[model samples]
Target: MLVRELLKNFQELANKEVEFTGRIRSNRQGKNVSFLVLNDGSVIDDVQVVYKNETKNFEQLSKQRLGAVVYIQGKLVPTPNRPQPFEIQAKISEIISECAEEYPLQKKEQSLEFLREIPQLRPRTKTFQAVFKIRSLLSFAIHKFFNEKDFVYVNTPIITENDAEGAGEAFVVTTRNDGKYEDDFFGKKANLTVSGQLNAEAYAQSLNSVYTFGPTFRAENSNTSRHAAEFWMIEPEVALNSLKENIDLIEELIKSVLSYVLENGRKELEACQNFFDDKLISRLESAKDSKFKVLDYAEAINILKEAVKKNKNEFEEKNIKFGLDLGSEHEKYLCEKHFGSPVFLINYPKEIKAFYMKLNDDKKTVAAVDLLVPGIGELVGGSQREDNFDKLILRSKELGINFDDLSWYFNLRKFGYYKSSGFGLGFERLVMYVTGATNIRDVISFPRTPNNLLF
Candidate 1:
């Protein structure tokens, strides 16, 4: 399996002979000469193969289909003066596999919607090739970021009886008969976890700095582009950390991740630039230099009210007083007009947030934060957990949650107490930020959105 990276060999080859196998992306035949474009995933660009009468398979290669695979032995030579830098002067060539005339992918453009239908074959196309490559590079960058910072990577449980996010909607993990769960998991009732905050918090208390990067499930019925039944979350928790410290760590983490992807995956970024506003890369780079704007819930309300007065809000107001959940529309308006980039909306009203959040001095707001990007509304959501036993139990009761199911979690606060703060960064949303991808479905390989499970 000899493979060559065409770009790596920039210098003119001095009668260098090489043997390689690759797919024929394009083909052309002249009176006495034939040319074939070949690529083997070793590089994004294809190398040109020039075959002459010295090869008996010239006729076979000339009649090959567009996507057929072929093997060629050739001497690399400079193009002399042409569009390409070099060309392969083939001494011998043979057809490895025939791609029949019915091959779906031609050398023409296809709509993303149409391409989505052929998920199994989309990678052969240039756009998806770049997208998936960027996806791999970004995942590596995320792991590298935490591993270098001494954050222990923790694998949290996927099936549980608990809803860690307290969102009340989770897909039940059951082996049932006709949707009846009486025979599932010993009839104990289990569901896929929506968040790993509680489990990750336990580890952070011991490991000091820990994180979980895994798939999380939610059964919410909202069929929006941002909502998904299954998605990847990057949750990082730190011990003895204040709310302000949590904000600082998040800003640093996001900036570092963006910088890594931008530097390592520039080609993919450029390939998909037309999908977003032209200022996408520059906007991200500018965020690295600018300070993140931090505002409390009250301050945010004030800003919104001011915007409303000035008619800056283009959409309908949802009675967004102080204690309401901000929708995606409101969030985008805030970041786009008020903040100009990434903003940390912190100290949310405790009654609206989860029970585990630490109570602030105001007794009304919790130590919570949601990082809102300009295009994507909420990129990361996190908070400092309440370490006090009595307060935690009281908050749990206030939220009408069954304390018996969470006895083990409370035991941590009862015995060994340590303050911890963490946040869940939506992995797909991060990709959307880096690539300017609009829908969450486009970023994930096979998105499990509502009513769409064809894959």
Candidate 2:
């Protein structure tokens, strides 16, 4: 029987014989009996197993090392007024496998940095057991949210020719001995895709709604606590949606995911609260019910400028002005300090935003928005796409982009154009927000950072 099932059905399974196999978390040997705490990774809690010297295989079982796997056939008996509700009274027990004393995971507190060195074994720890469980559930909730909204799941290619962001941060896909395009795999220059929005757009134009969840690569060298060499992104595109509708979708998505995790993942969240941040649960709970604020990019810049004037040395990069990109510090001050909630910073300068965003009537700003939260700076970035073919071509040429390479993308507007909008949310950042794991490396089971890729 699975430990989780046995525990959940304890009242029904009381006084009945059940067999379970799990790794020993802790073991204590007494003069006539032994106690074992076993975990099978099905749930957050472990089941206790009681064995005596008279039980079968007592000699071998009692001498088994920590982390050893064992099978116990026993009856469930109530443990009145204790932490654990029930324990197994062993009728027959045997050691399935033996672990040497050199087992890396000891029953002691280990630093997160130390655990990073042992990613292979870290999942067995209580903290990771909770974190990854929540991660799995949240990922499911994402699919469920989109599926319920009548969105089709599209599996876009991992390799492509167009730089969607046009930031030149793509990891080039090249295998030719002489670096010649004719000898490459696709017979043209290609790179690991940075975003699936363009491909999702293709499916959206046909299906009216589509989303892509997949791995994305960035070749940037900044090794910050938030930056990773590779990450997962959720990009959804819909036809005939304006910038306001896109923001509404983003807000709904955040609240829905948070509510699902809070309700279905209560145990995991509680465990995380006890181990990591004390405010993890409260932050999530408040976020789900809070009224999200919306502020234009120009107004946000004015607030930052006034902030700098009042207090010198407020921000690290303190020169606050319009048309300048908002740094993480500026994002935090606006969300945490000013609004005390999530804020949508919109209508950024055309020069700073991507070429695909729709241009406003002022001809200087684009309908781009970034969802900024308290602790995490930017959680989601989205925009109303440029639907006009000629205007898109103009912006592409102005950005010094070779228009021919993106003709396939612009052809969507050429053949038939429709109003559309989409957004990209970093999966790991969402995990960090939910789990309260500070560093990007801690949330990722096997993080891939600059010069640091380990299993």
Candidate 3:
């Protein structure tokens, strides 16, 4: 029987014999009685087993080390006076696997930094178990939310010849060592995709709505708590959707997923709240209930400028002017201090945004939007794509993008393509926001960073 099953049905299972296998989380031995805390990863809590000296292997069982696997045949009994509702009275017990005395995780609490070094064994810890559990729940919630909306999921190519973001940060994919691509595997230069939005857009032209959830690669050299060389992205493209409709879609999706996690991941959230952040649960509730605030980019800049005037040292970036890219500090201030909720900053300068964003009638700004939350700066970024062939071609040439590589993408506009809007949400950042994990490496199973690539 699983620990969760046994605990949930303990009243009906009283005095009934049960068998289960789990790893010893902690053990307490007395002169005559011994107690073992066992967990099998089915739930956040563990089960307590009591065995006395009457057992033949009492001495050996009492000496079992933490993390040692064990099998137990026991009877469920109510513990009216104890903290827990019930426990197992062990009738027979056997050690299935032994653990070494040199195990890294001991009784004392280990720091998150120390746990990062042992990624293989970190999942066994309570903190990581909760973090990963919430991660899994969030991934499922995203899929369910999109699937219910009748959005088609598409798998884009991992290797491609075009850089979707045109940031020149894509990892080169080639088999030749001489830095030549004429005779390479694909007979031309290719790279790992940084975003799948461009490909998903093609499918949305026909499917009307499509999404891509997969791993993306980047070659950035900076090492930060928020940046990773490899990460997962959730990008959705919708045909015939304007900028306002796109914003509505993002708000609905976020609220739906938040509601799903809040309903389904209570235990995990409580575990995280007890360890990582004391107000994690309440903050999530506020986010799910509150309406997201919307502001124009120019207006947000004015607000920041006024804040800076009120206090000269309010922001590190003192020059709060138009057309300047907002930093993480600025974004957090807007959402955390100014609005106290998620804020949507829209209509950014065309020079700062990607070339694919639709240019406004002013010919200076693009119809781009970024969703900013309290803790995390930007959770989702999207824009209404430029549908005019001539304007897109002009933007591409202005940015000096290789026209030959993106010929197919340009052809989408020339064909019968209509207005399409979409956005990319960083999966790791969402996990961090929901789980209260300060570092991006903790949420991911095996994080790929600049200089570290351990298993």
Q: Estimate each model's TM-score.
A: 0.93, 0.97, 0.98
How many steric clashes between backbone atoms does each model show?
0, 0, 0
Best by lDDT: 3
Off by over 4 Å in 1: 1-4, 10-14, 30-33, 52-54, 79-84, 178-183, 275-277
The alpha-carbon deviation from the true structure for residue 31 of candidate 1, after best TM-score superposition, in angstroms, is: 4.8
* Residue 174 alpha-carbon offset, candidate 2, angstroms: 2.5
lDDT by residue (1-455, candidate 3, tens digit) is 88889888889998899989999999999877789999999998899999998765777888899999999998889987988878888988898999999999898999999998999999999889999999999999999999999999999999998889899999999999997898999999999999999999999999999999999999999788899999999999999999999999999989998899899999899989888899999999999999999899999999999999999998889999999899998999999999999999999999999999999999999999999998889999999999999999999999999788899999999889989999999999999999888889999999899889877
lDDT of 1 by residue, 217-242 (tens): 99998878788899999999999998
Whose TM-score is higher: candidate 1's or candidate 2's? 2
- Global CA lDDT computed for model 1: 0.84
Model 2 lDDT tens row, 1-455 = 89889889998888999999999888899987789999999998899999997789988888887789999999999887899999999989988899999998888888998998999888888889999999998899999999999999999989999889999999889987687987788989999999999989878999998999999999999888888988899999999999999999999999999999999999899888888889989999999999899999999999999999999889998888888888989999999898889999999999999999999999999999999987788999999999998899999999998978888898999888789999999999899889988788878879888889756
